[model samples]
Target: MNPAKVALVTALAGGLSIGAALLGERWIDPEGGGIPLAGLGQGEPVQWPEIRLPDLAGHEHSSDTWSGHPLILNFWAAWCPPCLEELPRLERFAQRHADAGIRVVAIAVDRPEATRAFLAAHPVDLTILLAELETITLTRRLGNRVEGLPFTVAFDARGRHVFSHLGALEQDQFEQLAARLDAPSATPR
Candidate 1:
């Protein structure tokens, strides 16, 4: 790839990593068992719970669409500066990985009007899901009661939890994520 392409990918991964990490993690409700992702040394497969939310265009998004692929589910809000800074990188990540069977899904945690206004000014190509009333329920169910926006959760091809970063992502970090796209291929079918 050209320098620009390389730089772009690096930025996407790094931006997401940084922004999300700076936001840090929300302590999961002890009552709510957190879904284990990485740094746990947990050998179990990742599980992506079913989520149904509206898209920016008012269309419903079935989280199952991301099934059978490495899903990079990102959470953000328009009021969030880090998220706004990382939009383009995330969009580019989605485009390049479209053919790689990896999906980048952005869930807007803001209200409809705010989300609409943000989308209007900064159009993006990724499927922007709305974390509406239903999403709130799902977030709680997913052990995100403390609710940290600008979070990036990666799931394996089988919908198993892989890894997650809680801040802005840079290009290198993103490539590491993209590397996951090739991970399943290493396993026996």
Candidate 2:
């Protein structure tokens, strides 16, 4: 083939490969990380999905059951180091804020055995619910289409989303969140 023809073919192939990767990423992560607070209105009330799943002990519960209390819902997996590191902090935060009507709920997107084993080695007081592999869709519903581990979403007493974050959270961040949760609730719209 002529040198010019070879260069043209290579450029076209490279462009096609880049396009495919971008499309795939978008398909998998609709929310992506570009907009952390996208789709959620500021101070606007939005109803969260009714997430029903079983606790480590097998008791069933739903997200609505935690209504009237500020909730910090965290999606984690046993295999993720960051998720494991943040579990204890979340547990302590939940205990400290129990009197303030704040609850921390952890949803594990891992096999039951794996989650149980991890908990056994590193115990926590916060309720750990099993979402297993279904957590991919469940996290997306909670505005975490990036599917990153240790993602957290905070809801006000009215069950409206107040904050969301991806990646590991530091102690100070948790403290800040606790303060926000303890604040007076705004009138639901």
Overall local distance difference test of candidate 2: 0.72
At residue 185, what lDDT does model 1 achieve?
57
Q: On residues 32-88, what C-alpha lDDT tens digit does candidate 2 reach at each position?
A: 423234244245465555788999999998887887778888888877778888888
lDDT of each: 0.68, 0.72
User: Stretches of candidate 2 above 4 Å error?
Assistant: 1-45, 186-189
**What are the TM-scores, per candidate, against the unseen true structure?**
0.71, 0.74
User: TM-score winner among the candidates?
Assistant: 2
Ten-residue region with minimum lDDT total, candidate 2: 32-41
- RMSD per candidate (Å) reads 10.8, 10.7
Query: What's the lDDT for residue 178 in model 2?
Result: 76
Judge candidate 1 at residue 51 and give its lDDT: 81
- Tell me how candidate 1 scores on lDDT: 0.68
lDDT of 1 at 144: 42
